[model samples]
Target: MPVSSENKNGPYKPQPIKKVSTTTVVNPGFFAYTNLTGCQPYYCAEQVHLINNITVTALTIIIRVQKTSAATYHGVANNFWTGYINSNHTDNGSQIIYTFVLDPTQTVVASTTWYVEAQMDLYGTSQVTSADTYTVSVTGGGITNSYSGHF
Candidate 1:
């Protein structure tokens, strides 16, 4: 038997429609470095900006160190640090972008910043040495994050 049209208890009911809007933001990336002796300490810092999108709530910053010089005695070690910036709203993974730190530890002090120096020579022919520092600051609207690196 067919149900009466006056029945208020319908199996299928329609719901109200909803509307949504979206916008995208872009960020900038940069890098810088200095030369020094093997034993000397060095320090450098730079400011980076992180742009947030609707999907990402935070941005992760990763710092990596590479030996641009082939001095054999100068190899990079202990080269990784992590920091983050927040987006105004939640966002997908793709919305997050990374800005690397040049030096996070502040290990390289003034005058002592050297490219190469002689060691006690306990194990190998020579020991390689390097140092780095890093810091993160957010502008407009975002979370605060920071990390350091030494190598």
Candidate 2:
């Protein structure tokens, strides 16, 4: 995805495009960043949008989470830190689960979207003083997508 315009916020703004390459055109609902909500300045959960681009059939999607920064932080499950897909979709806590099963054997169709939320507490001595960068990546259906932000 490329930002094609500018706003008061600055450059690199996310824009909608129908063509990705000379041979390929974007699908009807393959939009990713339309629902993206970027990072907060401090002490807040950050969200990023994930989309399924494969239209052949429903496939299981998994998001691998990673966090790094010059600062340090501590994450305690069910406390200051938590990760989950949005309420409209099903999810599991221990592992990244984009549970789209309407029934036992069914999964969400392609072009469906989900948002992953992650938050943590700055417990280390340098955590509050430095910046923390969180990155998430997902690979499935021969396509890989990733996003990163600071908090």
Q: For residues 31-132, could you state the per-residue lDDT of candidate 2 as single tens digits?
A: 333121223343333333445555322222222222342212222111101222222222233222222112223333465545444443323322231242
Task: Give residue 77's lDDT in candidate 2 (0 to 100).
Answer: 16
Q: Give the candidate number with the greatest lDDT.
A: 2
Candidate 1, which segments miss by more than 4 Å at Cα? 1-41, 53-55, 69-151
In model 2, the runs with Cα more than 4 Å from the true position are 1-42, 55-108, 122-131, 144-151
lDDT of each: 0.23, 0.32
Per-residue lDDT tens digits for candidate 1, residues 46-136, read 1222222222222233332222222122222212222221112111322211233233322221211111111111122222324222223
